[model samples]
Target chain A: EPEVTQTPSHQVTQMGQEVILRCVPISNHLYFYWYRQILGQKVEFLVSFYNNEISEKSEIFDDQFSVERPDGSNFTLKIRSTKLEDSAMYFCASSDQYNQPQHFGDGTRLSIL
Target chain B: EDKVVQSPLSLVVHEGDTVTLNCSYEVTNFRSLLWYKQEKKAPTFLFMLTSSGIEKKSGRLSSILDKKELFSILNITATQTGDSAVYLCAVYISSGSARQLTFGSGTQLTVLP
Candidate 1:
């Protein structure tokens, strides 16, 4: 059972610093996604990537956020300037095809100071 | 805005008891509904229901979707301490843009011995 893997299980950074969350989605999957959850809130979709471009993004995914598949295996989310409200558990997910069940990673807990 | 609502924010039950969690959603171009189990940081896929009436089951857990009514239910029978976790329901919808997920707040279930 191959699963998505995320690096730096916990990240702590200054409010104005930049942060990058890394994920290695399942090798054969084509669609990748990023989602976040505030401490007590529902999981919110931020962005989705396919064919080497952003397929969709939410309003929360503003200019501060960017995603890339820098390599064949790594998918990363970079925040140019972190904010206190950006502190949350960021999750990476992938699916084999359209409408397929998306598998998720353990998540990286981002904490802004 | 697409929304997913889950009922009963929290629940507690004893061993061998049965419990059911409910999820309702209002989204355009509904594609599929998914159930996930979140024990701590990461969420694991449980079931994906694409059609109405047909049930998707794994062990003591089963889920069914009602597309006509715009709701879904997850049932866990003979609950154990291991079943104590937050259950999340997310709807996958693609109206005009790319597909994305809309998650409910989730139901926290605690099973005691």
Candidate 2:
């Protein structure tokens, strides 16, 4: 069903280290998004990208967070400095248009030590 | 800030029983409401409701939205063990040309055989 795919299902890194989470959205999708879910918490939006630029971001997506579509098929989220609070399941989603339903990936479990 | 609230943090039901999940939201410029089922990982899209009084059905699952009431409900009839999963409700809000989703804490459903 042409689903979004994320790499490194599990990631463990030191508190001060940098981490990059990778996603390959549906080939024909247009809008991309990043969301994270802290254990037992509601999923929170991080950022949304379209037309090769960030269209929206939440407060949680602060200076340490950045997203880029380095190539046509890949979307990446990088955290400059990891923190204990940053540990969560990061999910990637994509939609064909603004009004379409977004499809989510299995998610990357990021654990900061 | 937009908020989504889901009721009955968890539920346990026997096979063949019927279950209904609830979701309500408060947001400006409401765009749509979506329901997803999360098993071990990714959230699989179940239904997307935009207009009121319209019921979307798939197999034994059905969902409806009440835009006027700012709520939605998902019903699973004759449930099975496979229906055990966390049901997430999310609302899309439009901001200028951008939009993002705000998710509820999700209802955990466990179907016993």
Candidate 3:
């Protein structure tokens, strides 16, 4: 089965540094999303992208967060001035159309110290 | 805010046993409900339930959605050690031509031999 894939399985960063998490969604997918799971917490939706624009975002996706689809397949999330609370597993997901089951990537573990 | 609630945050079952995981949601204009299995890194897609009373099944796993009651259940029969993982339930809701997901805290299932 074709699956979503994320780069740099793990990332270690210091507070106030910048980080970029990359994902290559399934080739034919049209909608992309980013979610985060804090240790011992529920997975929370961060943002969803479609047609090169952010369609929806949560409070956690504040000023410091940005997402880009630089190319056909590459979707990335950048975090500027990371805080200690930013440490969590960031997941990328994609779906072919609306109301479809989304496919998820093996998450990128972001660790901020 | 859309909310998803999963009951019995953890479960333990012996090999060949059966288990059921529950999920309930409160949202507007529900689109679909999904079940995923998370081992350590990624949450693999399991099933998607859209219409109520219609069951979706794969091998030993089955899921059904109850729109009238705003709930769903995932059943695993003859569980194996490999089934030890966190089972996540998520709901997709449509909002003025946009849709987003809300996830519940997963149920950690440990199927021992």
For each candidate in turn, the TM-score is 0.98, 0.99, 0.98
Cα lDDT, all candidates: 0.95, 0.96, 0.94
Sort the predicted structures by DockQ, highest score first: 2, 3, 1
lDDT of 2 by residue, A12-97 (tens): 99999999999999999999999999998889999999999999999999999999999999999999999999999999999999
Tens-digit lDDT string for candidate 1 (A18-89): 999999999999999999999989899999999999999999999999999999999999999999999999
Q: Which scores better on TM-score, 1 or 2?
A: 2
The residue pairs found clashing in candidate 2 are: none
Model 2 alpha-carbon miss at residue A9, Å: 0.5
Quote the lDDT for B58 in model 3. Answer: 98
Query: Across residues A3-110, which tens digit of lDDT does each residue of candidate 3 receive?
Result: 999998999999999999999999999999999999999999999999999998989999999999998889999998999999999999999996788899999999
Docking class of 2: high
Give me the runs in candidate 3 sitting further than 4 Å from their true place. none
Q: Give the fraction of native contacts in model 1.
A: 0.84
How well is each residue in B1-113 modelled by candidate 3, as lDDT tens digits?
78899988999999999999999999877899999999989899999898999999999999999999999999999999999999999999887666778999999999999
Off by over 4 Å in 2: none
lDDT score of residue B6 within candidate 3: 94
Model 1, global lDDT: 0.95
Task: Please list all clashing residue pairs in model 3, or write none if there are none.
Answer: none
